[model samples]
Target: MSQSTDFDLTSSQTAEFDLTTVAFKSNPYPILARLRTHDPVYQYTSSPDGQSTWLITRYEDAEIVLRDERFVKDKQSTLPPEERAPSAGPAPSVSDLFDLGMLKFDPPDHTRLRKVVNLFFTPRATEQWRESVQRISDELIDKVESQKRMDLIEDFASVLPIRIISEMLGVPAEDSMQLHLWTKRIADALDDPAAFEQVASDLQAFYTYLLALVEKKRQASTDDLVCKLMHASVEGDQLTERELVAMIFLLILAGHETTTNLIGNGILALLTHPEQKQLLQAQPELIKPAIEEFLRYLAPFTITTHRWAREDVEMRGKLIRHGDAVLVSLAATNRDENKFDHPDTLDITRQENPHIAFGKGVHYCLGAPLARLEGQIAINTLLRRLPAMQLDIEPEALVWRTGSTVLGVNHLPVTF
Candidate 1:
C-alpha cells in the first residue's frame, strides 16, 4: 500500500501512524515489520482516541509483555477508583461487561473466572464437536452449491461459526443474526472512538436481551453451554448474576467474531496463494499444518486486547509508566525474521511453528482448540467440496473490515 520502511526511527518519530486509513487496514504488515525491526517497543498517540499505547512488536518482547504479571489486564487493579479506567463502567449498564470479563482481569480474579469454563474448551472436550462441525460445514456448502457464485464470507464463513457457537449457547437459530449484527457493531466501536455513543446504546439493548435469555435458560435448565456455566461453581464459588451475564456476553462475542474472521481470512489466504492451495489440494494430509500457516500468515487479530502497566517498567530501552496502555502486535511477531526462517513466505509444512496467533502464557486464547477445529474442517471441506473454486472478482475489489481489532475481508466473491 505505501512505501516500506526499514525501521527508520527518525522518520517514524516525525510522522504519525494512522490506523484508521483504508491502506493501513488493508496491509498493516509492512508498517508492523518496520516497527519490529527499527523500533521494537514504539509508543504512539492513537489517531482516533489520542491515547498513548506502547506497541510491542518483536517476538521476544511481545511474549514477555503478554506473560508478565506486572503488566495487568484490568487497568483498575493498578489505578485508584477515580484514577482507574472504569473498573466496572457504571452501575445498571452492560457497558461494564468488558471490564468484568476475564480478558481484562489479572490473576486470582482472572484465574477464578477462567476456571469456570476452561474444561469445556480444552482440546479433549472440543473434539467431541468434530462430527457436528463437519455436518454444519457441509450443510452450509450445500446451500451455496446451486448459486455457484456467492460471497464466501456471508454465505459460508460467517454462518458456520455463529451457528456452532449459537447452538453451544442454546440460542435459537432465528436469533443468531441479531446477535451477529450487534457484535459487529460492538467490534466496530472498539476501533473507532467516534462510535462509542452508538455502541453504548447497542450494548444496553444487548444487555437486556442477554438478561432475558439467561432467565429463560434458567427456567428450562437445558443441556447447553449456558446451562453448564450457570450451574458451574469453582471451589464452591458460583458466578454472581452480573458475572454470569458478563461471562455469556464475552463467550458470545469472542466465540463467533474471532472464528468468523479465522475461517474467512483462511479461505482468502489459500485462494490467493495458488501454489500453497495446490499443495493442500494434492495432499489433503497437509490440511492441519496449512491451517496453522493460515493463522500465522493472516492473523485474525492484529493486536492483543489492551494491557496496562501496574507500575513503572522499563522494556526495550523505553520507560512505561503506571497505567499506560500496551498492545502486542501478533501479526508482527508472527512474521519476525528472528523467529522464522523466511518470515514472509507461506509454507504449509512449517514444523514446530511457534507462532503466537492465539497468544502465549496464562491468558492464551481459551477457545483456541475449537477455532482450530472449525478452521481445519471449514477450509479443507470447502476446498475438497469445490475443487474448482476460484475468486470471481479481482483482488483489488476486496474491502476489509475497518476500525476493528480483528482483520478480515468484508466480502469475498467466489465461484466453483
Candidate 2:
C-alpha cells in the first residue's frame, strides 16, 4: 500500500505524528507531503525525548530552518533542562560527541574546530587519499572475492572506513581493529534509550581506551593528520586535551558511521532496483553521478541539526515555541515535490540533487569529501571487480536496524 493510503490521518492519535509510523521511517515522503499540504511545519512527537518538536517537511521550509539564525542548532542555547538529563543508562556517545569538541560549540568555537577539521578533510586533502582509498577498497574486495556468500556489513563496509581512520589518526595501524567493538556498541546505543545508558558506560570505557592512544600520539609525533592535529593551532589557539579527544572521537564517528551506512544503503538500493543496477553495469562512466544519486536515495543522517527555537518563530504557519526542539527531517525534504523532477524514482543519472544528505549551512558535514571519495571509489570498485555479486538472501529475509534514525542495514548477505 502507498504510504499515504496506509494512514488515516483524521484520527486524533494519527493526527499527532509519531516516529513509529514505519512508513515515515522507511519511506516517509508521501505522508510528510500529505501533512505538509496543511501543515508544512508540523509538530512531531519524538520517542527519544517524549515531547513534541517542530518538523519541516517541505524542501524550501526545511532549508530556511537549517540556514536561519533564529533556530539555534546548539542544544545548550536552549533552556538547560529543569535539571541535567538523567544520564543513568547505555553509552551517551552523541551527547559526548557534541560536548567534547567542535560539534557542541556555537560561532567562534564551532568555526574554529570546523576550520581545523576542514584543513585535513577538505577536497584537496581528500584527493590525497584517493589512491589510499582505492587500494583499501581493492584490498577489501579481494578478501571476499572467492567467497560464495558474505555478510557485507561486517565483513566489508563496517571494517574498511574504520581501518583507514585508525591509520589516518596516527593510531597504531594494527590496533585500529579494536575500535570495532566501541563503534558498534556506541552506534547501537544511540537508538535505544536503555541502550543509551549503556552507551554512557561504554563511552567512559572508550575514553579510557583513547586516553592511552592520545598520550601515545603526543609522545611519538609524526606527519599524519592526527599528529598534525596534535601540534596544530586553531586561529592562533591550541586545542586542549579534552578538545583533542573530542576531535578524535568525532573523526572515528564520522569516519566509520557515515560511510558504512552510505555503502550499505547504496548496496541495498542496487540490489533492490535491478534497473538502476543494470544501468550502472551498462554505463560505468556514470559512477560519479550514480554515487551522488545513491547517497541522495539512501539519506542516512537522521536530522543531525536538532535545535531549540530561541523564541517563538512561525515556520510555514506553524507556531514554533521558544525553547522547542526543532528536528530537521532530511528524508522528507530530499523527496519534496519542489526539489526534484521524479522524487521517488531511483534515477541514477539524476542531476541537480543538492540534497541535504551532507547537511547545509555552517553545520554542513566536514567529512563529506572523504565520504564521497570513499563511496565513489568503493562503489566503482565493487561494481567493476565483483561483476557476479548478487544478493544471497531473499528480499523478505532482510532485517532493518532498530530505532536507527540514521540507518543502512544490519546485514547484506551477498554471493559472488
Candidate 3:
C-alpha cells in the first residue's frame, strides 16, 4: 500500500501521532514524511502526566540529537524538577539488576563501561562466530526444509539468536527455552507501563536465574563471555556486582532482540518486494549492501533511546527547553528524501547508505557487526535453501506488534 494517499495530515492535529498503535505500526513512513516536511522538530504531549517529547524526524536533526553531547541519554539525572518522572522506587527483590547499562550513561562512564564488552563485538571477534552462525543457520533451515511451512519468527529467526546468546553466556542447551521466554517477555514489556507488575516479576525471576548462572561460572571459571566479563578489569577499574549482572542482562536483551527484528523485518521487506528478492537471488553477492538497504528501508527501531537536553537549545527554528525529552526517529530519518535519493524505494545495491538504524556516535550499537553477520548468513542461507518460499497469508492480514519500541510482526507464516 502506497502511503501517499493512505494518510491525510489534516485528519488529526499535526503532533497527535503516537507510535503505540497498530495503525501507526502498520505503515509509519507516510506519517514520518509528513512530520519531516512540516515539523522536523516535532513535539507531542503524552497524556495523564502531560509530559512532552520532542521528536526529531529529519535526518540532519536526528543525527545531531544522537551525537551531540548536550543531549544526554539518562534523563533521570538531567531532567528538571517538574520534568522528571516520579520515582518508581528501588528494585524490590531484583536489586539493581534492572539498572541501565552503558547505553544509558554518558561521557567517561559510557566510555569506561563500553570498553569491557567492546572487544567481543569487533569485526575480528564477530568473524570468530561466523562459522558457528552458519552451522546454526543450516540447522534451522534443515528443520524447516522438510516441513515446507513455518512461522519464520518463532520457528527460525527467534531461535537462532537466543540459542547463540545462551551458549555465549554459558547457559546449557536445556535451559535455552526458559532464557528465551524471560528475555522475550522483558522486551515486550518495554512500551507497556501497565505491565510493570508483571515486568517486575519477570525481572526478579530473570535476575535470580542470572545470579545462579554467574555463580556457577565463577565456581568453574569457564571460557564463556560471562566468565570473561566477570574477570575483566581496566586500570584498577572493575564492574561492580550490580553492574556486572546489569551489563550481562543488557547484552542478552540487545544481543538477540535486535537481530531477531533484523531477520524478521528483512524477510518481510523482501517478501513484499519480490523484485528486490529476485535481484538479491540473482546477484547473490549483494547480500552485504542488501543488509544495509534493509536496515535503512525497514529500520527495525522506529526511534532511538530517549535523550534529555542538559540546557536550553535552539535547532531547526525550535527552542528545546532544558530537560525536555528528545527522541530521534531512525526509521523516519533513514527515509528522509532530503538525505537519500528515493528514500522509500528498496534498492539492495544502493551505495552511500549511511542509515542510523543502529544509532550513531558513542552509543552506536556495539553488537552491530554481529547483527550484520548473523543477518547476512541467515538471509543468504534462507534464500539459498528455500528459493520458492512465499507468504502464506495476505499482506494486509499480517499483524504488526503493538505497543513496542521494536517494530516487528509477532508471527510470519511462510511456505516453500
Candidate 4:
C-alpha cells in the first residue's frame, strides 16, 4: 500500500480504550479524529477485562488493509483445532461454529457465495423488488406519521429493513417483530460482552425459528430466498443444510443492522444539521448524492471489516505478524481528511464522494443497490409526504445507542 504510516509493532505501548463505554458510546468522532491524525496504527490493548486489537483509522491505511487479500478473513483455518471446535466436548449451536456466509468466506468461496446472493440484487433483478421496497416504506411511514413523536429507530429505521428482509426470505409478517428483536439482541451482544450470554441465547432462538421457516420453505414451493437457495446450484455444488441456515442468519442480520443505522443515522445527521436538511428539502433530486454523502458522513459500521495478516506481510510500513487481526475503521476512514476534502462536513453536492461504507474489493456489500433504493425512497418520501417534518427534541437529547457495534441512535423522536 502506498503512503505508508510507519510504526514499530514490537516496541509499541498500548492505550486504554473501552470500545463499549458511554464516553466512546455517546460520541466516537473526536476519538476517531484524534487517532486518524496522531496514532494512525494504534494498538488498543486491554486493561483488565477488555480485549485488545489494532485500530487502523486513516483513510489510506483503511482502504489498503480492507482491500488487501493478504489480510485474510478465514482466520478459522489458522486457529488451533481446540479453538476451532465449540468447547471440543459438546457440539454447540450453528452460531458457535465457523459460520461461513459470504462475509465469512475468503476468495473463491467469497466469490461463489456472493454470486449466489447477488443474483437476488443484480440490476436486472432489483427492479422487481422496488415495488415491494416502496410499498414497505410507505406503510412504515404511515405508521411513523401516526405516532406521537415516534422513534426514528424502532418506529421506522429498524422495522423497515427487517420487514424487507423477512418478506424477501418468505418469512411471514407475523414473525417479523420477534425476528427483529433477535437480530438487535444479536448485534447488541456482539458489541457488548455483558450481553453475550443473552445474545447467544437469542441467536439460538433465532436459529431455531429460522429452521422452522426453512422447513416450511422446503416443503412448499415459494419464490422467497430460502427456496431460491434450496433450488440453486453453482458449479454443480448445492448448498448444504448447515450452509443454508448460516446464509439466512447472515443475510438477515447484515441486511437489518447496517441499513437500519443508515436510515437512523442519516435522519439524525440531516436533522442535526438543518442547513443540509433544508438543501435536500429544496431540491429532492440531490437525494442520491445526499445518500452517498450520508453513508460517508455517518458511516454505520464503525469497523465494518476485520482480517488477520496472512504471512507477516509489510503494509503501511509496518510488519504485521501472521494471524494478527487487522481492522479498518470505516467509521474513521469515511471522514478521513486525506480521502475526503472537508471530510467532516456533509456536502450533498460534493463532486466526488468515494466512501468505503459498503466496503471494497471482492467483498463489497451485495445489498448496496437495494439499501440505496430503500434509503432514497424513505428519505425523499418522508420530506414530500410529512407536512412539516422536524425533530421534536434536541439532537443532544436523543439517546445514542450505548455499546453500539454499528453506530446508530436508539431513539430519534420526531414530529410531523
TM-scores of the candidates in the order shown: 0.94, 0.89, 0.93, 0.90
Give the number of the best model, judged by TM-score. 1
Q: List the lowest-lDDT window of 10 residues for candidate 4.
A: 7-16
Candidate 1's TM-score: 0.94
Query: Could you give the C-alpha RMSD of every candidate to the true structure, in order shown?
Result: 3.0, 4.4, 3.9, 4.1
- Which 10 consecutive positions of candidate 3 have the poorest summed lDDT? 1-10
Error of 1 at 205 (Å): 2.0
> Which stretches in model 4 have alpha-carbon errors above 4 Å?
1-16, 46-51, 79-92, 96-98, 144-148
Candidate 3 local lDDT, 194-278, one digit each (tens): 6545778778888898888888888899989899888888776777666788888888888878888899999999999999999
| lDDT by residue (tens digit), candidate 1, 1-416 | 11223344455533435555555668778888877877788887664446777888899998889989888887778867666565574564675577578787788888898898897899999999899899999998898898888899888887888888888889999998888888877875675677767788788888999999989998899999988999998788677777888988888888787788888888788788888888898998998888788889888887888888989999867888988888898879999999988978888888868899899888999999999999889888998999889998887778877664777888899999
lDDT of 4: 0.75
Give the winner by lDDT: 1 or 2: 1
lDDT of 3 at 334: 95
Clashing pairs in 1: none
Clashes within 3 Å, all models in order: 0, 13, 0, 0
Decide which is better by lDDT, 1 or 4: 1
Where does model 2 exceed 4 Å of error?
1-24, 48-50, 79-97
lDDT of 4 by residue, 316-386 (tens): 45567778777778778888888889888988888798899998888888888878888888888777777
Clashes of 1: 0
